[model samples]
Target: MTDTRRGSIQRLDNIAVVVDDFEAAKAFFGELGLELEGEATVAGDSVDRLIGLTGVRSDIAMMRTPDGHARLELTKYHSPSPLAGDPQAPPNVLGAHRVMFAVKDIDDIVERLRPHGAELLGEVVQHENSYRLCYLRGPAGILVALAEQLG
Candidate 1:
């Protein structure tokens, strides 16, 4: 069979999250095990035009997952400052809810992230015999979930 979605779209480059505390957000994801691929400050007319904003100046940290299949881009705006939103917005709120990662040890990951200000939204629970999962709020109130496969 032919692939219906072959050329319709390519891979997802990354998911960008804007934040207030740039360093903290970077550290949070770093502690979660994402490697720092690179960092740069973006500006200029091209950037403003692309994002539909004026005088845009933002610093970005590109984080890569250990498996190299995914990336999370954390952005901190310097000029034309970022707007404030509900940092503690519940999962029921609209828009992109949470970003999930497949972890090897759910409990250990959760415990390690605690000092970095990770707050569990609920206790980790097993789903049948397939996996264990939990949701937690990280820096800038970004919701993240972890799942560990079971044998």
Candidate 2:
């Protein structure tokens, strides 16, 4: 009898986020301390077909954490344009609402991002001795949560 087991799945490649402004989104995530990995512009029918959009042209920027375990793909659509949505939508509204990160100093990171217009969704709070966390609203209404682990 032949074996019918499937191959093991690989690690996550990256998380993609659609944004309105390319440079602003890059700067926002950069301020949060994620290193910029690379960037490129993609277009033509091949890209459109791959993304299931018509005549899609976009600029993509990839950012990875210093540890290099996680990554984010930021895309700014130029052709066909991006549609507007509720920027103030709550976390429970559904869809991909936020991305969380483990940081060494959450407070300091938050302070640094404040000048770039990042607003805390709520005050930073500690959950017993597990973690200290807070969510910040970044450019294009992207929500980012930072958690500092307690020793």
Instruction: Report the CA-based lDDT of candidate 1 relative to the real structure.
Output: 0.91
Model 2: ten consecutive residues of lowest lDDT? 1-10
Q: Write the per-residue lDDT of candidate 2 for residues 1-151, one digit (tens) a residue.
A: 5556687546788988888878888888998889999999999988878879898888999999899999999989888889988887877786857999999888899999998779999899999999999988888888898999999
lDDT leader: 1
Candidate that would win on TM-score = 1
Q: What lDDT would each prediction earn against the true structure? A: 0.91, 0.89
- What lDDT would candidate 2 get against the real structure? 0.89
Clashing pairs in 1: none
**lDDT tens readout by residue for model 1, 12-104:** 889999878888888889988999999999999999999999999999999999999999999999999788888889999879568899989
Candidate 2 deviant stretches above 4 angstroms: 1-8
Question: What lDDT is reached at residue 72 by model 1?
Answer: 97
